[model samples]
Target: MMEQPLPNPILFHPLKHHLGYLRDFAAQSITWPEPELRKAFQRIGGSQLDLYIGPLPSLQIAEEVILYLQQRHLLTPEPYRQHLVPVGYRLCTLSDGSAWALRWGLHTGRHVHLHPGRYSLHTLRIKANHLKTALAVTIASIKYNQPISLQLLNQVRAEWLELPPVTGYTSAEGLGKVLDLVPGNA
Candidate 1:
């Protein structure tokens, strides 16, 4: 049997790593609605978030925390609204009209840009739902007795993007994927 080939990262935005930002002609257009989300998001994109790790804490701990949250359905990250590359950067679709990749990082340390959508009212709501879910993951870290490093949280986001969307969910139950922790860059 032959191994399957991996997908290529879109060359259109070679160095772009920001989430929700769309670019064309080398100039960026639009900005994220909630700027703070950028910080949380950037860590997963490529940058590292120092949440107590402070120069070499156990990365294993970081990975564990995020997996725990997902197992409980506390964080059901919306799948990457874009390409299926294995790493670094992807062109995500935020909504119909608006898109903004905060001048930040990438997925699993992967980085890329996004393309705009139709800008319909329904798209807007979906965009909002997407960000809300991402932030919900962040909030869980803050509320957690053992705070989860944003880097790991974003890594979880990276892995989640590789999955199918969690549909027909209830607040009481979480996404159906079993708890399997993806190894970290550590």
Candidate 2:
């Protein structure tokens, strides 16, 4: 008999595991331009870069951004499928084994959500060059006031590569302490 794979793996991505702390850290990094910083904070924190366009611009622009980043190998899609569900829950897989799972809550065309699939951190690690690419994607989406491209992504990715990864945030409090986002000692 062959061994079977576990149905679900553990969540161990340092940044994602303690996303709240990371969000706070990123939010507090900027001081001036309080309003814009606050908005950026919410967008990056929520991992919803679609809001940067004021009123959540068209999904077309977001697709364009995805295309640009994908071409540069900044972000890749994971292999997965969805079961029979409502229209809003459906996703169309691409030729490159990728898919788009957008959320069309009220203002459908105005917002282009990232494929709302629950991807395992382990899969992200082994397949998509680790969480570094996700970080690069987030930075690329945020830094651009207008233009979005592989060149911009590469630049941000290079800067991010310099920052070494710090692991071992087993507890929420511990993560908060290291990020200096919360007011408590864990």
Candidate 3:
């Protein structure tokens, strides 16, 4: 029996619709209505207040839009700050799911990471697992009586991104358990 060839990994690029949404969002003529912004965000799969992280470009665009809106005072700072918590949670979920897929050798091509530079599938997998572990630790600290704060979550995410990639293993179950400890999870 011969091993089957893996399907080509899908190369990811930011979608035109999403880019259009971002452009319209940044345009000065627009009144920056919250409802309209929410609608556009939903259209780009942000309805649940969770960002799409599969494509690196989409995440980058969302970050830029969030920063732009905040800088312009277009969005209420508190609510938007709370929104960052879920975004971090979503990143952990993505990392866990990606690790599982890589572990099974399924859809390797779909695991592309484009930011900072294009990364090979193997490197992407390693980074995903490492991120999951780092985030899990951060959440655990919160669970063990550390106060939950948006500033801390933001710091953890920024630090994780800046850290050199290293190999690590974190089970989906481990991530899921810590995730429940996140604020608003009840």
TM-score of each: 0.18, 0.28, 0.19
Candidate 3 lDDT over 36-86, as tens digits, reads 433332332311111222333344433443354456553443443344454
Instruction: Tell how far residue 124 is off in model 1, in angstroms.
Output: 1.9
* Candidate 2 deviant stretches above 4 angstroms: 1-35, 45-87, 108-116, 120-186
lDDT of 3 at 142: 42
The segments of candidate 1 whose C-alpha lies over 4 angstroms from its true place after superposition are: 1-6, 11-39, 43-113, 118-122, 125-186
Candidate 2 vs 3: which has more lDDT: 2
lDDT of 2: 0.32
Q: List the residue pairs that clash in candidate 2.
A: none
- Candidates in order have lDDT scores of 0.28, 0.32, 0.30
Q: In candidate 2, what are the lDDT values of residues 60-139, reduced to their tens digit?
A: 32454445445655332221112212554444343333333444323323222343234422112121222333334343
Candidate with best TM-score: 2
How well is each residue in 1-186 modelled by candidate 1, as lDDT tens digits? 111221222112311221222111012211223344444334334322111111211222223333433464432222332223354333222223223221222443322222222342222212222332344333333334334444534443544333233433332322211111111110
Q: Which model scores highest in lDDT?
A: 2
Question: Which wins on lDDT, candidate 1 or candidate 3?
Answer: 3
Which parts of model 3 are misplaced by more than 4 Å? 1-116, 119-126, 146-186
Candidate 3 is scored at a TM of 0.19
